[model samples]
Target: MSNEFKDILYEVGENAVRITINRPEVFNAFRLQTVEELIVAFQRANEEKSVNTVVLAGAGDKAFCTGGDQKAHLSEDGLYGPRGTVGLPIEELQTAIRDLRKVSIAQVQGFAIGGGNVFATLCDLTIASEKAVFGQVGPKVGSADPGWGTALLARHVGEKKAREIWFRCKKYSAQEACDMGLVNKVVPHDKLAEEVEEWAADINQMSPSAISICKRSFNADSENIRGISFMGVQSVKHYYMSEESKEGVRAFNEKRKPDFKKYV
Candidate 1:
């Protein structure tokens, strides 16, 4: 019940473990430490005898998570270099997501983009507010790798749609994402938490062991599927630091559309 997490808040209640991203100053952007904290939190929840479900959300009204911290990424070491760098703990986070034994739900409000979308898609179920916007904006920021998104998204929305989102950086509304099978449900902003709680309550009524077994069965089939590759850390860093990526970043910062037309 302590709100002591540096970048997130953790609480246990109603047989559920709730984790809220707390960095509203930058719209809940994920730092290396934040991702590491999430992995530990999820692992702890998995071990707790009293917890049957896990819920993830953001602290503020404006964003569930905007993505990685761009300012951090632009540092001298870049996003994938050495310890305490952006994207390094992402693989660990993904492992935690795949290994979660209990039902996990993402309660999304606004702007679940890039790494945020990756995190949400890691959950077993995604419950979004009608005002939420989901996108793979990493391409606009200079990389196309959505770390955990490569596998989870293709499973939810098909390879074609996933490719479009990743390669083109398309944004989808909550309703659109639900229609496309990205989100499980979309509710009003004011009722999102209530809806999630109601759904969690219903899910918790089922046999936890049975649910866990079924989830394991479903994941087993896709365990070896080609998804995000951590081996490409150097390549991703190179891409982001490339001239094209610089142009993409500049276009985004300048509020103009990127001219990737020529690159294609």
Candidate 2:
């Protein structure tokens, strides 16, 4: 929430709170530090009583986010930040977006892959640019988002599609995402901000109290998203502590296929 944010951008507009993952060089993948910044940024938006909606985005017109920072994940602690036992504050960010009462929207441009896809999935709505790509890469990267990225995704796009998404790790185009119910709408890359702002404005015109009730109503039946946050992080944490887990991170950094068979 502080102006000193290095990994992301946070701005409070009259009607909306906009947060952008600012690391374009790595296709906007999140490090543990980046996830920590997101948690604080979402907290900033949640506390803004006047804000009617929150916009989640990525910088440089490429990749809204690509999930955990593989480079940083190479360390001993793997993908954990300073907070939480496992160090991934993703569950907190997801909770902040859901519990904020206001509409949480993902304004995705491109490469919303891995856990980044969960950033879009768990949102109340997703508006994407024509260039946007959505997918899961956890298995390929020696990771997985067993939280909302799995159960909630199944609810959105069905069990079979969700399985294919995670198991196959194939990226989907914006229109494909729309047809699969991953996004609400898609526009030209140049018009993404305009479209998202307009949607936020319209949502702002609605009664905040009413929206709050509606959001809670929608989530009241499903609490597992919050409950399972630790499972994914913990599983990854366990793998990270093992010598076998080194291959994926090493192969990723080296830009080659991970020889998991060697580990087996």
Q: Judging by lDDT against the true structure, name the best candidate.
A: 2
Model 1 score (lDDT)? 0.79
Model 2: per-residue Cα lDDT over 87-164, one tens digit each: 666667777777877899999988899878988998999999999999988777677777788988988888899999
What TM-score would every model get versus the actual structure?
A: 0.88, 0.94
Backbone clash pairs for candidate 2 read 81-87
Model 1 TM-score, 2 decimals: 0.88
The regions of model 1 sitting more than 4 angstroms off are 84-87, 226-228, 232-234, 241-264
Q: Per-residue lDDT tens digits of candidate 1, residues 187-248?
A: 99999999988887887778878988988998887776424355555467666655666666
Give, for candidate 2, the lowest lDDT window spanning 10 residues.
77-86
Best candidate per TM-score, number? Answer: 2
**Residue 58 in candidate 1, Cα distance off native in Å:** 0.7
